[model samples]
Target chain A: MDEVRNVIELKDVTKDYGDFKLDRVSFAVPEGTVCGFIGQNGAGKPTTINLILDVISRDAGEITLFGQSVDRNSAALREDVGVVFDEMGFHEFMTGRDINIMMKNIYRNWDEAAFFENLRTFSLPSKKKCGAFSRGMRMKLQIAVALSHHAKLLIMDEPTSGLDPIVRNEMIGIFREFVMEEDHTILLSSHITGDLERIADEVVFINGGRIVLTGNKDEILEKHGILKCKKEDLPGISESLIVSSEVSSFGAQALINDRASAEKLYPGAVIEQAALEEIMIGYVNGKR
Target chain B: MKGLILKDLMCLKKQLTTFVYVMAGTVVISILYVLSTRYGNLARVGEQLLDQNNGMSRVDVKNLGSEAMVLFMFLPIVCVGDLMNVFVADGKAGFYKVSSSLPVPLYKRVLARFLTIYTLFGLGVLVDALLAVLLCSMTDIMSLGQFLGVIFSGASILSIYSALMILYCVLLGYGREQYAQVLALLTMAAAFVIIKFDSVRFFVVHVLGDGVGFDSSVFWKPLDFIREKGYVLLGIAALVSVCSYLLSVRIAERKRGVI
Candidate 1:
C-alpha cells in the first residue's frame, strides 16, 4: 500500500496578536480529502487561514505547502493553490471579462477558455459589472476564479455561509466535482457543521486558538456517543469516559469519548452515536 | 505583476475618462489661444495694453499666453495620474486580501504599483509632448524645446510626488490613502524647505522682512526654472523612486503589507 501524502501541513504554528494567539496549531490535511476546519467566530479560524496563505506572518512554527517550507518566501507554491474568502475581493466595477484579462496575465497556467466557460456555467454574465451581482453570484464568481487555473488545493473560508440552501447545495456540488479528481484536496473552514458532515472526509476542530480535536470524520463521530442515564446513576459511569455531562429533572446526559466502551460497560443506559456538531459542542463545552 | 498593473489601471478607469475630456478641452482652447495670439481677442488686448503703457511689454503680453498654455499642460497630468486613488480603491474594495494571496511576490506587487503611476505619467507626458508640438507650431511665445522642458519638469515633479505617495501608502497601510496624500505633500514641503533653507531665508528676510524691491523677473522665475532645470528634477525623481521602491519592498516584506 502507498503511504498517503499530506497536501497541507502545519507543525506547531503560532501567531500572536496580544489579545489572541494561535497557540501551537498542528494539523496535516492529506491529499484528496476534504478537511473541515470547524471553529466558532473569533476562534482564530481566519487568522490561521491568513497565516497559511502567508497574508500575515506567523510568530513561530513551520508551515509546509506541497512539501516545501512556507517561510522561504514560497509564493510560487500558491500557483497550485486556490483560495476563496467570504467577500468578493474583486473591484465592484470589474466585469468577468476584466477579471479574466487581469488573471490571465498573473497565473502562468491560467486558461482563458476555462475561465469564461466557468462564468457561463455559473450563470455569471461576462460583461456585467460584478457589483450588480447578488451575494450568491459574488460567491459563485469567486469559485469560478478559484477553479479556472487548475489548482490542486482549494482553501475556502466559509464559502457557503450566507447563501440560500439551494445555492449552498450547488456550491457543494461544485466542490464535489472538484474533489472527484484524485489529486485535488479542499480545506474548508466554516462554523456550519452540517455542510462539513455532508462532505468532509477529515475534520479539524479549533477553538480559542487551540486545536480541540482532529481525526477521520467517521472515527470521531463513531468514537463519541451521547449516553443518557438517571441522575443517581451518572457517577457510576467511568470518569475517563465522560467528556462532559448535563443534568435535567428527568435524567443525566453525558457525552462519552469512547462510545463502544460505554456501551459495553453500561448496556442498560441509552447510548446513541454523536453528530459532528454534537461532538464539536461536547469538546467545546468540555473545554469550558 | 502585469496583472496587478492592469488591475490598478482598471481602478483608474474613471479618472482616465475624465483625462480624455480634459485633453480634448485643452486642445480646443489651446488652438484658439494660439490663433488669438495673432488675430483674435488676445491680439487686441496686447495692442490696448501696449497703447496704455502700464509698464508691461509685448514680451510680457506673449508670456501671458505662454502661462495660460502651461496651465493647460498641467491639468491633464493631474487628471490622469494620482497614485492615491489606486490605494483608495484597493482599500475600499479590500483587494489587498486577494492580491496578497496571488502567486506574485511582495516586492513585485510594490513594483507593479510604481509602474502604474509611471504608465499614467508616461501617457500624460506623451500627450503633452504632442500638444506642445502643435502649440509650438502655431505660436512664437515659447520654443518646442522650452515646452518639452516644462512637460518633462512637470512629469518629473509629479513622479516625485507619486513616488513619495506610494511609500506613504505602504507605510501607513490600508484605508489611509488620504493621509498618505497629505503626508506626501507635507514631506515634500519639509524636504524642500530643508534643502532650500538658504533661499527661503533669503526670500523671507530680504523680500518680505526688509521689504526689498519687488522684481518683475519673479513672475518668469518658475517657467525658467522648470524649462532649464528639468533634467536635475528628473534625476531627483529617479533617485526618490529607487529609494521609495527599496524602502517599500522592505516594509512590505517585513509586515506582509499593503500593496
Candidate 2:
C-alpha cells in the first residue's frame, strides 16, 4: 500500500469546550485501507470524527478529507464522505422510504435503487418506522444509507459497540466489501478491538485525546508481546520498559511494546504475542 | 428541497387524522347550534324571514357571523404543534445529526420546514372555512355574501397568524409549543379587551376587524395595515430564520467530546 497517499488527514487538531479539551491530535488514513480508531469511552474518538465532518468547529488544526482541506470545501468534501454514528439519528416516525426520499434531494448523487437494494440486502423494512427498530436494525439501516451514497470515505464512530457477535461479524464483512474498491476507505472508531483485528489493515490508538500509537496491524501485533513470569521474577523485570503490569497470585504478566528488546533484556521471561484488546488495556492503564 | 417537505409531510400524516376529526366535529356542532335555535321557534323564524324581506338591518346577525370566524384560530395552534414536533422528534431521536450530515445546505432545510408548516396550516384553514360555509348554508340566519365574506376574512387573518407562528417556532427553542399556546390565548384576551374598552374601540375596530364586514370602505384601512405591517412581520421572520439556520450550522461545526 502507498502510505504517503492520505485520504483523511488531521494536523494538530485541537478543540476546547471550556471544561474539556481535545489536545493536538493528528493521524492519517491512506486510501484503500481500513484504519481502526481504537479508544476507550470518552477517548475523544467521536470528538475527532465530529471535527473532521465539520459537525463541530475546532479551535485549531486543519482537517483534510478526500485530499481537500475540510474548512475550504466542506460541502464539496462531504458529498463523497459517508458517516454513521453508533446511535441512528433519524426521526422515530420516519420509515426507510422516507429517509431515502429525504436523502435523494440532499445528496446530488443519491441512488434510490442502490439504497433500496442495500435495504433489501439487510432485510430492512421500507415502511417500518425507525422508532420501532431494534438497535442492531437501526445500525444496519444507517450503514445501508452510508454505503449506498457512493462515498469514498466512511467515518463511523463506534458502529459496532452494541451488537451480537453474529451481527457484528456480518457488519465487519460488509465493511470489508465496502473497501474493496481502490478508491474506497474506512475510518471506524470503536472500543471493540476484536472486530478491528478481524478486518482492519491499520490501527490508530487514542487515549485522553492523544494518539499513543499508530501503525500497520501486522506490525503492531508482531512487535508487541506479553511477558509472563513467576511472582518472584516480577521484581527482577525492568519496570522502565514495561508498558503495563498486572500482578496475580499465580504469576505476573507485563505488556512490553518492544518484544525483541524485552527478549534481549530478559532472557528468562516468557514472551507471547499480545492480542489487540490486551495491548489497548495495557496502554490505557500504564505500567506500575 | 421537495424531499425535505415530503419527509415533513410524512411525519405529519398521523396528525392529519386528528385534523379531519376536529374539522368534522366543528361542522356538526355549528349545524346543530343552528338547527336547535332556528327550527325550535317557528313563530320567531317566521318573524326573522319577514324582517329580512322588509330590508330591516340585521347587524346582530352579522356580528355573530364574525364571531363564528374566530374558530379558525384553532388551526394555527394545531399547526404550530405539528411544526414543533419536527424539532423535538429530531432532537430526541438523534436524527438531527444524521440529517445535518446530508449534503443539503442548512438554509434550504429550514426553509423547507417553514413551507411545509405554512402549507399545512393553509390547507387546514381552508377546510375549516368550507365547513363553516356548509353549516351556514343549511340555515337562513346568514346571507351567502356574508358567509363568503366571513370565510375570506377569516382566511386572511389566519395567513398572517400562520406566518407569525412559523417565526415563533424558529425563534424559540424546543418547548415553544407551550409558549405559543399561551401567546395565542393572550392575543385573544387582548383582542377582547380592545373590543370592550371604549377608549381602544377605534384601535380594535380599525386594526382587528377592518375588512370583517361587507362594506368595501372598511376593507381598505386594514388591508393597508396588513400591507405596511406585513413587511415588518416578514422582515422579522426572515431575520429569525437566518439566525436559527446559523445557530444550527454552528452546532454542527463543534468538536465532539465526552458529554
Candidate 3:
C-alpha cells in the first residue's frame, strides 16, 4: 500500500466544559478516506468537529488539517472544505438562489453552475424558501452547497440521521462519488452504524470523549466476534477473551476480541462474525 | 466582509422593506401637510403683522420642525433596533456557528456588522436633514441654524446611544436573549434615574426635551454649546465609537468559542 497522507491529525486534543470534557482525545483521518466518527449523543463528536473548524477553542493539544495548524489555516483552508451540520445553518427566509448569491461572495472557489446543477439534480426549487424544505431535501441542499465549492474535504455531522433509507443510500452513493478523486476526504459523524459499515474506510469510535477504537474498518471487523455458548461455559471462559456478554435464561453470548483465541479456548462454543453495531455495543457495554 | 453584510441585509430584508415604505409614506404626508398648512400659517403671520399692536408678533409655527427632530432621535433607535435584529436573526439561524466554518475572519465579520449599522445610520441622518429642511422651509418657525443645531444635537446624543448599545450587545455575547432583555430593562431604569442628575438633565433637556423645542430662552444654549465644543464633542464621540468597536471585536473573538 502507498503511504497515505493524513488530511486531519489530532494529538491529545482536550476541551473542558466544566460539566463535560473531551479528555485528551486523539485520532487522524487519512486523505481520500471516509472516516466514520462514531459516538452516542453528547459524546463529543460535535465538539471535535467544532474544534476542527476553529469554531471553538481547545484547552490543550494540536489539530492540523491540510498539513497546517487550524488556527492559521482555518480561513484559507475553509475555501477548500465543506461543512454540513445536523440542522440547516441558513436563515428561514433564504431561498436556494439567495444562498448561491451569498456563497458566491463568500467562497472564491464557489461554482454557480455546479450549485444550480446540484439543485436540478436534487429536484430542489431555487425560488422556494428553505424553511419549507423537508429534512431529506435540506440535507441534499447542504450536500449541494458542500460539493459546489470544489471542496477537498466534507465534514458532516449526522448527515444521514433522519433521512429515509432510500435517501440515505443516495447520499452514501454521492459520498462514494465524491471520494473517487483520491484527493477528497470525508469525516462523517453518525449514529447509524449500518451506514458506516457500508461506506467507511476508517472507523474511530469515541465514548465519553475518549477514543475506544480507531483503525481500518475491515481489520476492526475481522478481529472481533460474538461467541454463543451454554451458561455453564460462561464461567470457564477467560475474562481476557470476553469483551462483553449478555446472559439469558437459555444460554450466554459474549463478544470476543480475538475470534481465533476465543475459538481455541471454547471449542464447543459457536462464534459468529460481529457487525459494526454489535462491536460498538459490546465495547460500550464492557466500558460501563 | 461583503458577504457577511449581504447576509445581514438579507436577514433584515423584510424589516428594511417595511421601513422604506414607511419613510416614503412619511415624506408624502409631510409634503402634503406642509403644502396644506403653510399658506394658512402665512395668512396668520400677515394678520399678526397687520395687528402688530396686539404684541403677539409671531405664533409659534410649531410645524413639523420638532417632529423632524424627534425623527432624528428615532433614527439611531432604528439603527440600534436593526442591529439587534441582525444579531437575533443570526442567532436563530445558528449563523455564527456556520460562519466560523467559512473563510471570513472574525474581525471581518464584526466589522461588517458595524459597517451595516453605521451605513444605515448615515442614511437616516441624511433623510432626517432633508425632512428638517423641508419642514423648516414650510413653517418658518426655526431658523436654518436652529434646525441644523437641533439635528446635530439629536444625532450627537443618538450616536452615543448607538455606541453604548453596540457595546452592550457585544459584551452580552450572541444569542443571550434573556440577558439582553434584562439589560434593556436596567438601561431604561438607569436612563430614568440618570435624568435626575444636573449635568445629565442639562444635556438631555438641551438635546431632546423642552429646551430645544419649546423654551426659546434656553433654545440657543444647545446650539451655542455645540458651536463652542462641537469639535471636542465630535472628537470624543469618534474616540468612544472607535473604542466601542475595538472592544466589541475583542469580546466577539473571546466569545466565539461559546457561540
lDDT of 1 by residue, A1-288 (tens): 989999899999999999998999999999999999998889989998888888899989999998888775567988898899999999999999999999999998898999999999999999999999999999999989999999999999999999999999999999999999999999999999999999999999999999989999999999999999999999999999988899999999999999988889999999998988888888888889
For each candidate in turn, the TM-score is 0.97, 0.79, 0.87
What candidate 2 gets wrong by more than 4 Å, as runs, is A1-3, A230-240, B24-57, B70-81, B125-259
- Over 4 Å off in model 3, which ranges? B41-81, B129-159, B173-197, B200-215, B223-237, B257-259
Q: Give the Cα error of residue B223 in candidate 1, in Å.
A: 1.6
Residues B1-259, model 2: lDDT tens digits: 7877877777677677777777667667666666655666543654575587654345444334334434443443354335655655655676557755667555566667667766785686567557656766776655445444444444444444444444444455444556754564566457548655763564457656673433433434443333234454345445544554455434333322100
For residues A38-113, could you state the per-residue lDDT of candidate 3 as single tens digits? Answer: 9888889999998998888899999999889997568888888899989988888889999998899999999999
lDDT digits (tens) for residues A206-261 of candidate 2? 99888888989999999999999997888887777688988998899998889998
Please report the TM-score between candidate 3 and the true structure: 0.87
Candidate order by TM-score, decreasing, is 1, 3, 2
Worst 10 residues of 2 chain B by lDDT: B250-259
Q: Output the better candidate (1/2) by TM-score.
A: 1
Provide the global lDDT of candidate 3 against the true structure: 0.79
Against the true structure, whose lDDT is highest? 1
Candidate with top DockQ is 1
